[model samples]
Target: MNKSKVLLLKNCSTGLVSQVMTLIFQFLTRSLFIRYIGIELLGVYSTFTSVLSTLSLAELGFQTAIVFSLYKPLAQRDEQQINDIVNVFRFVYDCIGAFFILASLALLPFLKYILTGITVTNAIYLYFLIQAFSSACTYFLAYKRSLLYADQKDYISKIIDMIVNVIANILQIIAMVYFKDYLLYLVLKLMQVIVSNIWVHWVCARLYPFLKRGKINFTLLRSLFSNVKNIFAGKIAAYVYSSTDSLVISAFISTVQVGYLVNYTTISQQLKTLIAGLLNPITPMIGNVLATDSEGESKEGAFKLYAVMRVLIAMMIVVPFCVLINDFIAMWVGAEYILPASVVVLLVMDLYIHFVHSVNVDFINAAGLFREDRDNEIIAAVLNITLSILGAKTIGLAGVLLGTVVSQMWFWFGRSYVVFKLCLQADKEDYLKYWLKNIVDGVALTVSIVFCAYLNSRLPIANSYLKFVCSGILCEAVSVALFGVFHFGDPEVRKMLKYLVNHIGKR
Candidate 1:
């Protein structure tokens, strides 16, 4: 295997492990929150967290742009350049942190509007403030971790992140169960953020001590700031569409309803995060390959990567679609707050679009076309917010999702296609042909498996648990079989599989 492949595999393995642990932790945390705190408090918690996330605009797009800038320098093993970049980025991060502190403080007057759901209780306000402060601290920590990621040390980062999250979540569950206090829960979360970020900084510093030695480069500072301007604007726009939706919903809908919406959104977002963890480490590698290799080699590698990613995305989409998430939610969180069927369906659709968007967006960002990417994000944000609000007012949550899908067609899909074309210098027809083939194969396989699972639901199962277990197993089995037979049977996929088999056999 080539060095890139080896690094990809290492990162993927560590990422998968981290994702699994994180998912488990999330499940436990969600379960505890639902059972102990109930939906009302969960709503308050969710809204507060969402507000805190928006405050994370402090880090801006510097983290992403900085990572991209580091790829070539890191690849060339230019120690001085790496040190300069790191130092300059850290200095910027501190400025951003200060900005966040000031922003958060300034937003206090407007907290009543933002925290619309939460009562004006002193304790609740304090909890929200603490969450906001924690979020600010986390931004600085994340800047340090971005250096590690850019250096292709994501495996190390992932391990530390996963371990910290798992430990923190366990403590959170204990806090919820024992104390059942929302303030205590928020405090625990704050502690988690502080500890996790500190760990990230510590780990990165240990791995690359040279980062700590560099003098600030004003020239690098100017360039970093310039790139960050576009990135920051893009992130603000992205957050508008992503995090702002929840805040908007909280504004119009009941807090309990916000809680329900957040729960479904959380599941969908977690799934995305899991997929991203698997694919994201390779993004910088893609940039590095494009920067270092011939155009043909880069295109070929990208095509292969896209193909593999589509298969992984198929698994991500179909598995959740197949499992009766409504049943799972009912079982997990109780039927009292079970998400409506329409809400669930809309959530799934949103996730599908989101998955596609992620694949294309990562490629676009990796290609260093931040300006165009930023423009697309601006369009997406405008359309998303406008449509979601209109939809929510007219039709409700499903309408919000419908608006999102409608917005994506022109804004996201069109922009992504253009980015793909521009970055890879590949023909539009060729790209469409590949994706069309995957869509057809994936749809057919998904339908066949879902049909099989639907039939199994007709059978008499003694218990709900057993039925769920059987349905899940049946869905996965049929999907894998159908995908393998129809999709993996393709010559290219087969060759890759055979190579993997032989490679593993030798190992």
Candidate 2:
């Protein structure tokens, strides 16, 4: 396991530790929020988290710009360049921190307007301020955290975040169980975040001793800011995509519905995180490879590994969600919280499409292709916003999600063309055909698995828990057996499998 495999394995391992802890915490805490905290406050809590994201938009891709800059220096082992880059980033992040505080306060007057059905105004503001301040702490002095990832040591941060999240979530649950005070629970979260930021700064110092002695100059800052400007559009696109729906849902529908949406959102988000946890480590490897081989002569092999990974991960999540979301939701919470069938189907479809789109995006970002279709991201964001608001007004929640689906047409087509042309220097037809073939294989295998599972008489059960468990296991087993046989029969797939096994065995 060298760079690519090593990075992937470590990231997945550490991410699993954090995700397992988070899943446990979320299971207990979400149930508690519904039972003890009421749906309205749950909306407030989730809403403010969204609001904090908007406020933090002032960050404006500074950290990402810094991380991208870091790849060159880290690969070259140039300590001074690394220190200079880190220094400028710290100053910019500090300014971004102060901007967030001011921006959040400025929005306070309109907060009640954005949120529907808010009775306790002061509590909302206080909670918003606390969340904002706690988040800002990381920006002020934590810029050095990028080095951990650039050096492929993200496991350090992942482990730290896991410990903090586990402890914090546990304490918050206890506070709710004992006091049942929303404000108290929020306060504990803020304190835990503050502590985590400080701990991250300490870890950064311990890992990179050279960071403490560096002189910053505008020349360096200006050079780094160019990367920042290039990637800023991507940053906006991501934040807006993730957070704007909350605003729309809060403004148009009742705040309570936003809480209900989280029932579906929680699972979607966790699956996305798990996938990212596995794939994100490969990004730096891609960057390193491109830095050395700009012609992308290395891409065809990488694409095969990525294509297989995309199919496996996407099906592992989407097939189950499509087949068993209703049953899972009914068993976990209740039938009452489940959305309508239309919305459920759309959500699962969105997850599948979103994951497929994300596969190329990691490569695009690694190749510094953000500036290629920066304007198109603006178009997509605007389209999503307009369509979401109108769709929610016309059809309902499913319509709102459909807006996001429609907007991704650019990603599936436009971005792929650009990456295939500019970065990989490969034929667009070949790339498109590869993806088309993957979609066909995945869909056919999924249907076959579902039909076989149904034939097994393991589905359509009366009991919710039994239906979810039986269908989930059968779906996974059948899908694996079929997909494995389908791909393992390919010489290319067999060659890659042998290479991966040899690499890991050597490690």
Best candidate according to TM-score: 2
- Pairs with steric clashes in candidate 1: none
Which one wins on lDDT? Answer: 2
For each candidate, what TM-score against the reference? 0.85, 0.88
Model 1 residue 304 CA deviation (Å) reads: 7.2
Clashes of each: 0, 0
lDDT of 1: 0.72
TM-score of structure candidate 1: 0.85
List the candidate 1 regions with Cα displacement exceeding 4 Å: 1-10, 71-84, 115-118, 140-142, 200-216, 281-305, 308-312, 357-359, 423-446, 449-453, 481-507
**Model 2 vs. true fold: TM:** 0.88
